[model samples]
Target: MAAIVGSTPTFVPPHVVPPARAIKGLALIAGFLRNPLEIVPQDAYEQDYVAFNGLGPRFAWVTGPDLLKTVLLDESDKFSKSVQIEFFGPLLGQGILTSEGADWRWQRQVAAPMFRRQDLLSFVPVFVSATHRLLDRWRRSPAGTPQRIEADMTEVTFDIICATLLPSSDATVGLALEASADRLQRSAMWRQLYVTAHMPKWVPQPGARRIRAAVRALRASVGALLTERRRALSQPDDLIRRLMAAHDPVTGASMNDEQLIDNLLTFYLAGHETTSKALTWTLYLLACSPQWTVALTEEIAEVTGGKPVSSDHIDKLVLTQQVIKECMRLYPPVPTTSRQAIGDVRLGEHLIKAGTSIAIPIYAMHRHQKRWRHPNAFDPTRFSPMNEGDISRYQYMPFGAGPRICIGMAFAMIEITSILATILQQAKLALADVHAPLPVARITLHPKGGMPLRVWVP
Candidate 1:
């Protein structure tokens, strides 16, 4: 048994922060490139908070639950976003995720209703249909053949988002959308590094030209679709159509074409990347813990009762939801988020001065030794009915917390929960590789190569 387990490669080792010192200049950037997860020194974990004096900027890594609340939730306004995030501007434009102040408020208000419970409930069928399509394809392959689970999840989630938001797009258009987003995600890491180094956007770095081309293609495709939708005699009540009709209650203003394109790209990129990563990690964990897989499958069998999953049936899938919640806790889709102080801010005993960057290390926070018992262990029970209440509101922020929480939080949850239920109901999954996949951080956390798994009929 040890040999079978050992056959797979080592799990990506946790990066330990080097001893305290003045880490600055190119050394700082090199340290980050080596392992983004080691965002702070080992002492930071013991202390739960630490400040660093470095060349490029003065920053603090805050992991204490209360401190995170002050930075991300309570005193959020005092902490604006860091300039480093502008690396995404080329791909995301000035969408809600990147916008701030009144602009963010207006966009949120205009698009809020589209993600309400009732609206998401309407997407249940779309989720199930997309999952079934993937299952159909998987069924044709040999039962024990290795499958690239990461790519599979990415394709399915991408398809589901397109179906829900752009219902009229055909397979050809769907492929184009996928291609464009893939180009951006594949190149995002290097682009972020270049931007962080203060390199100009038009410097024509190695792959920058291709990435720019992909971004332009994506915008053009979305723009063409929007134009076509406008010319249609009647429009479907999908996300795109609804956004076109939505108006800001305060200003009574509607989103123009440019605004629509930016928001659509934001929704597509955000929703697609996070959901796929969540599903991939969930499956990997379940593969490692087959007993839990059996438990989840059994629970699905009981609740679903050999029928399709519906919105009404979702509420009863208690254990299934817990499994996903636990998976997210162990592997948050968006691993880390940072903010910069706009002015001097008092968080707990420390005074963070203006122009300082604050790292809300969500990845470290989830596994902080002081915060969660056996923080490294995989235990879905932590999120079970009886134990969930014990967790601090700020401690478990997979979709983040407070006002700037992910707008697609509800949509992503419903989609992930429904798809997990639907897939596990029809198949049993096992990791194809003997070793675990390495978790590499990019724009989102992804398995280094892909999550290879074997699918079989139970």
Candidate 2:
């Protein structure tokens, strides 16, 4: 492992201090809409499993690493993506993320080669240029200016995904998609509420019409871009071109227009949001921990040796990557994942009945008392090459585990490292205000309010 970066990091960044008691009844539903992390009882941070019976369906909250493996891996086949689909199906369609069974299998098979390590590495230059553009904008601001970094991160990541996956997107379409992301997330939350209460999909909710309109407009934009991608047959380097040419080997079939639109929207929305949250949190941590920030800045200089941060420097920036890993551990992008049982089943000597919902509150798991020495501290050494292997795969899964793991893991990591390295090389960012932003679970783990930081060259 790379030598420890300065002393052991002890600065505990702002985090969600879960409620002492679990909220129940309408309060639970209200909490779900407000911030689902609040719904996680305090003891989930210390215990393996917690059960609830009063909800419409039985709820099983599992944080035990061994049981988590069973639910997410060993007996994964016994669970269905019902709850997840109910939440995302309206927006994402039956794409790789919301689909299951043979349908999901074939889609994953077709999408696998697109994220090859070599192909993802080739995107490093694009990622760097995107970051440079954002930095240039920040540079225009006078010194001692607090930049809206949360918004900036979102914009840069969106640019990277669009450039690599959908170059055919026009400025208008791109802008519309960006504006609708938060609205769609809100709409999805209501969808989750409807499912939990056994309400029908067509039932009315707040802002339902506007959200539906946005969904229509977003799909139309992707559909138009997909059409354009089809016309540009020579551009085989991009994801759309590659997907257009892919076929299901068993049946020798290509994706239909709807399927193409489904997957394209899946990648466009899901691809960038997670990475943006990661970058935002990592920057927040750096701003708070001066020693690690200096250590990382020094390491970046050592790795690049004054040259631009290229793909070669990514692996060499071991401490930088460790900091990102630790940041993710402290604030996972998607704080919870869930599955509904296909039938009654036994997990760790507990009987989970058919139709029961199993929730893996990842935020709680990452900070469970038994998981680490100081679960909430911002320590990167725990993720260093030597110690990382000691942690169970299920315990530290920011991108998730098993077959349904995020397909764009490599793409996200490369973009994050490239962008972070470039930003540090160009300027220093520090917290603009003393007010600490608490973690909130939205579509992504958003730091409530927003993350504003002062950017200036040292």
Candidate with the greatest lDDT versus the true structure = 2
Off by over 4 Å in 2: 1-9, 200-203
Error of 2 at 449 (Å): 0.7
What are the per-residue Cα lDDT tens digits for candidate 1 across 1-458?
Answer: 01111122223232233446436666766766654664456555556678876523567777888888888788999987655347667766777887888878878877788889887988899899999999988898988778888999999999888888676444666677788888877776566666544456577666777898998998887887787788889887777877788776768888888888888888888888899999999998888876678888888888778798899878788888887997887788887777888999898999888978776667777777787776667777778787789999888898888799999989998999999999998987887967666666677888866789999753
Model 2 lDDT, residue 165, Cα: 77
Candidate 1 lDDT trough over 10 residues, lowest sum: 1-10
Candidate 2 worst ten-residue window by lDDT? 1-10
Cα error of candidate 2 at position 335, Å: 1.0
What TM-score does structure 1 among the candidates reach?
A: 0.91
lDDT of each: 0.78, 0.85
Positional deviation of residue 166's Cα in model 2 after best superposition, in angstroms = 2.1
Candidate 1 backbone clash number: 3
Candidate 1 positional error at 248, Å: 4.4
What are the clashing pairs of model 1?
Answer: 8-434, 8-435, 9-435
TM-score of each: 0.91, 0.96
